[model samples]
Target chain A: MTFTGLVGRVFMLPLRLIINTCVRLRIHPNTLTFIGVLINIAAAWALALGKFVTAGLIMVVANIFDFIDGKVAVELGEVSQFGGFWDSVIDRFSDLSLFIGLIYLYSQLGRTDYVMITALAMMFAIMTSYTRARAESIIKKCKVGFMERPERIVLFMIGAFTNRMAAVMWVILVLSVFTVADRIILTYRELRDARQVAA
Target chain B: MKRAASLPARVLWNAFYWTYERATWQYDLMVIAILAFVWLTPPDWLNDPMASGCGPLGWVLAQLR
Candidate 1:
């Protein structure tokens, strides 16, 4: 295994321990998920204000909590349909609020182009998630894509920490759109094959 | 005498299987795509937004200066 993999495993150890503790305490996973979303919103707002390093730190910490919620849920045997649904819904809102905060900051800075691009990226990102949901609903497989939520969060952190907000927006725009397109194509192929067989 | 299923019936079964398999493929593909995107993208691309030097990065650095 790669050194980074080893480091990641080591870092996750403490988180796992915390999750176990939460489980033993019988804490509700949804509560932790909500807390995670709140932290993400705060971190995003900090980034929007150009507090890059601070925002990056907060984002990283928030993501750790995000990861822990699921483990906590599984350990506590408190996983429920509502728990997953709540997480998904809050995640969407958290993502939007974060970008909206950036929009506010960029508007204040008079960078309209960056604002537009960021908005586009945000739209595409949301669509990417929606496409998967819709495909699944239709009983078709459509999960082929290059960007996912974890990567998106990491990219945001990198942008905030390194102070390269434009680059982050660009990456999000390209990858998120690509992911959406990938899903559409996959869905089309599936439906087409099904049709051919029916004929 | 045992008779083979009709062509229409065979086609229907194949179609059903195809739909099932494709849906399963899509679900798995989404997971793979996400992983690849995150792991493959360059850090430089990730850093571009702040590179403009006129946005938040600039504002923060200006305060320090």
Candidate 2:
């Protein structure tokens, strides 16, 4: 493996340990995943209150739990269809809540310009994931895009920590929308090709 | 059942496979990093019209002011 992959694997060691512990204790991965979602929602709510640093810290903690859940599932051999589905569903909600909180914050601050951008960012963020999900429903492949969930989370963390609300919103809006469009076009071509081959 | 793959088909398949193998992980990570940086650092120039040189968007906002 490359150095980066090695690093990623190393970073995941603690998560694997947690997963093993959970498995030994008979704790379900889905339960941990649900708890992670709850933590994330609470973080988003905190962000809405302008507790940016607190929100950022909470998000980091929640995401660690999120990572652990996957490892736990693997260790416990409890990876289920519903587990993946619920995780994804909650993830979307978590993503949306962050931007929604920001929008509410900007609105309360009377920052109209920033408000629209924040709303747009939230919309685009949802659309980005939606495009990928929709495409997967039709195509067998997941199209890689410029912006993905990890990137979005990083952006939000940066914004929270730096107090760069408006800039973050603008970046998310532009990049997420672009990613959505790119995925849609990719899916359309793939599906069309598949149809042509069948015909 | 005996049809041969066309040149375009072969080329496209190879290209897709190459891209899938080579770029997916790194590209996704890079995009994520860019988003993180932008979000974390809202440029001061964005909020300051004078600093931003009254660019098109800034100029328009200035008109409203």
Candidate 3:
């Protein structure tokens, strides 16, 4: 087995247990998804309120829900186009809420500089996801980027736990911009290749 | 959109399909770095007095006082 696969399985053990319990409860995946977003909003609220440790802990719980929702859906045989769409849309709102919290916190601290930096980070983060989604609509898959949602979430948790949010913002801004560019380039290259093949 | 596959097949496919693929050793190293940073970083570094102390509501209260 691959090294990452082994690590992934070890990490997923607890999550699998949770997924099983949720499955036995016969809970709807959409409900789980809804609950996840609500928890994320609470995490954002905590972040805005300067409860950094509490926010980090809450975000861990929130991401557990995010990670398992699709698994629960598949287990329940409840995967649908709408389920996918709902998950994607709710994710955007969740991402926006976290950035809003950071922006609000910075503004409250009278740090206009960090507020602008956080806003730019947020914009690039959204663009990272948007570019992939838009490119995927044309291409079969547009998973060319290195800084995907999982990486971003991990970085957020790290920032919150370490109180290194300023550093985290800069990292997110740079990596997300690169990710956005990577996706656009991938789409362009793929389209050009397709046209050549057709010609 | 189409439910052509059986439940088991669908589950198996979804398992691989949805999970993010971290193909390289660098990805694993990155994960390790994150875990290390979270656990090992000193509290003093990047410590923001304003952020860690008074929240928005507290700031507002201070303003009124």
Candidate 4:
């Protein structure tokens, strides 16, 4: 198996039991997704208070909810287009809340520069998702990016655990910008090629 | 997957396998850049010096000392 697949499997191993329990409990997948967002919001609150370890731990639970929701949906045969869309929408909120916490913390510290940097990172990160979602509407699939949501979440956990969030922001900012641009170019190429094929 | 493989050999093989599986120069470059920033960048540059003296790893080192 590939490295990422191996890492993903390892990460999911512990979550598998939780997922099975949720499924057996017959919990609604959307309820799980909603609960995940609430937990993530609490994590953002911890982050804003500069409690890195607490925030990190809370995020781990939030992500477990995130993982379980999808698996439960699949296992319970509750999968639907709206479920996917709702999950994605909640993800955007979850993603932005973390950055907002950082921004608030930096703003309180009067570190306008870090606030700006954090904001830019947030913008680019969302744009990476936006570009793929927009591109996939045109192309069959547009996964031509390296800085996807999973990578961002992993980086967030690493930064929180190590207290190296500044460096993590830089990495996210650079890679996310590249990913957005990559998607744009790939979409353009695919659309142009499709046009040529039609002609 | 070979159980008889030496540790260093397994590490080297995994490195090769990872690069091959990544399938994009940009992915490799991004990984390298992150590693470089982690290794080479000054803590002061990021402006979070509170963690510099006793971040998680530093605290562990302090405990050891």
Candidate 5:
């Protein structure tokens, strides 16, 4: 296995325990997804207050639920289209809340430039994920992007912790916009090749 | 399935697969580390421009100036 795969699995160990407990308690995965949103709401509030450290820490814990819900759903054989849809919807909300908090913070500081940057970053981030999902509907898979969720979340948290907000937002915006373009091109090729073969 | 990809395409495809499936997460953690390092180390020249340059980052910092 790749080292990252090993690390990822190790990271998931504690989560597996929680998933077990969740199964024992008959807790629904959808409920867990909703709880994740609530935790992120707190993180957003922290961000708006410029409590970067608190928001960073809160985000770390909150996002764990993202992994746990999916694993629990799969382990319990409860995976469903609705469950996936709900997870994606909640994730977008979480993404938006972070940007909105930043926008509010910048507004208060009267940094109109940062406000626009945050808004642009947020829009491109959503588009990056959207392109992948829309492409997946028409192709086998659409993981052809550099700014996937893990990167975006990790970079944002690092930016928060280090107080390099501008650098992080710029990186996210550039990479996410590039990712959206990459998905479009990848999807086009896949569809085109499929058509050529069918003819 | 269509015929196998040509050798160059195969090599490129494998490289992309390795990046997406295997190396990207580890690389992401490394990037986080690197960004932190850049912020912490703060060579004077880099910091100066970063604090008041023309880009989005500089513009944000300029608000505080």
Candidate 6:
């Protein structure tokens, strides 16, 4: 096995057991997804309260749930378009909540600049996902960006834990905007090529 | 005017599709990084609302505060 594969196997051993138990409980993956978002709401609450460490730790646990739902879905053969659609919708909400928390804290701190930047980051972050979804509507596959959701979550986690949110906002803003642009260009090219070939 | 895929277009396509294929693994690495950073960073350091102890981040936060 490759190094990451080996590591994933080792790490997932426990998660696999948890998922098996979750499956036995007959819990829907969507339920797990819902639970994860609720936990993330708690994380956002922590952030708004200026409890950075608390927020970070809670976010860590919350994302572990985020990862688990997929495994549970795959293991139980519950993967469906509806399931995926709901998960994506919920994920956007989850991302927004976290950014809202950060914005709240920034506003409280009277960092109007950071607050605006954070708002911009949140908007572009949503656009990052939106561009892909919209592109996928017309193209075969629209997975063309580096600043996708999971990376944004990780970057936010880093900023929260390390108290480097300014750095996080800058990264999110630049990369998310770039990602949106990348998707637009990629989809445009793909459609144009398709039209040319058909013609 | 229509032509074959240019070198730059081909390069971009390959790079993006390659990235797409390995996106899961990349996400895994980022998760590991976040967890490791959280574990290593002291609670006090992380809990500093104003980031008063970090380097540039702290300086920026201090200015904002």
Q: Which candidate is the best by DockQ?
A: 6
Of the candidates numbered 1 and 4, which has the greater DockQ value?
A: 4
Off by over 4 Å in 2: A1-10, B1-42, B48-65
State residue A22's C-alpha deviation in candidate 3, in Å: 0.6
Name the top TM-score candidate. Answer: 4
Sliding window of 10 residues with minimal summed lDDT for model 4 chain A: A1-10
On residues A1-98, what C-alpha lDDT tens digit does candidate 4 reach at each position? 54455566797788888988898899999999999999999988988888888999999999888878988999999999999999999999999999
How many residue pairs in model 3 have overlapping backbones?
A: 0
Residues B1-65, candidate 4: write the lDDT tens digits. 54899998986444333323252454455566676675355556577622454344455556799
For candidate 6, lDDT tens digit of each residue in A38-151?
999999999888887899999988887788898899878999999999899989889999999988998898878778888999999999889888988899988776778877
Query: Which docking class does model 1 fall in?
Result: incorrect
Name the lDDT value of residue B1 in candidate 2: 12
lDDT of prediction 3 = 0.79
lDDT of candidates 1 onward, in order: 0.73, 0.72, 0.79, 0.80, 0.77, 0.78
Predictions ranked by DockQ, top down? 6, 5, 2, 4, 1, 3
How does model 2 score by TM-score?
0.76
lDDT of 1 by residue, A1-199 (tens): 4444455679779878888788788878888888888988898789678788888898887787778877788777778898889888988887887798788888888878878998999999999899999988875556566577876887788667766566667768977887787778778878888889999
Which 10 consecutive positions of candidate 6 chain A have the poorest summed lDDT? A1-10
Q: Alpha carbon lDDT of residue A36, candidate 1? A: 81
**Cα lDDT, model 6, residue A103:** 89
Which stretches in model 3 have alpha-carbon errors above 4 Å? A1-6, B1-20, B30-65
Better of 1 and 3 by TM-score: 3
Better of 1 and 6 by TM-score: 6
lDDT of 3 by residue, A1-199 (tens): 6677786789899999999999999899999888989999999999898787888999999999888989999999999999999999988888889999988998898988888888999999999889988998999988865678888887888789877777677667866777787778779989999999999
**lDDT at B37, model 6:** 49
Model 5 stretches with alpha carbons more than 4 Å out: A1-7, B1-19, B24-65
Which residue pairs collide in model 4, if any?
Answer: none
Question: Which lDDT value does model 4 have at A83?
Answer: 97
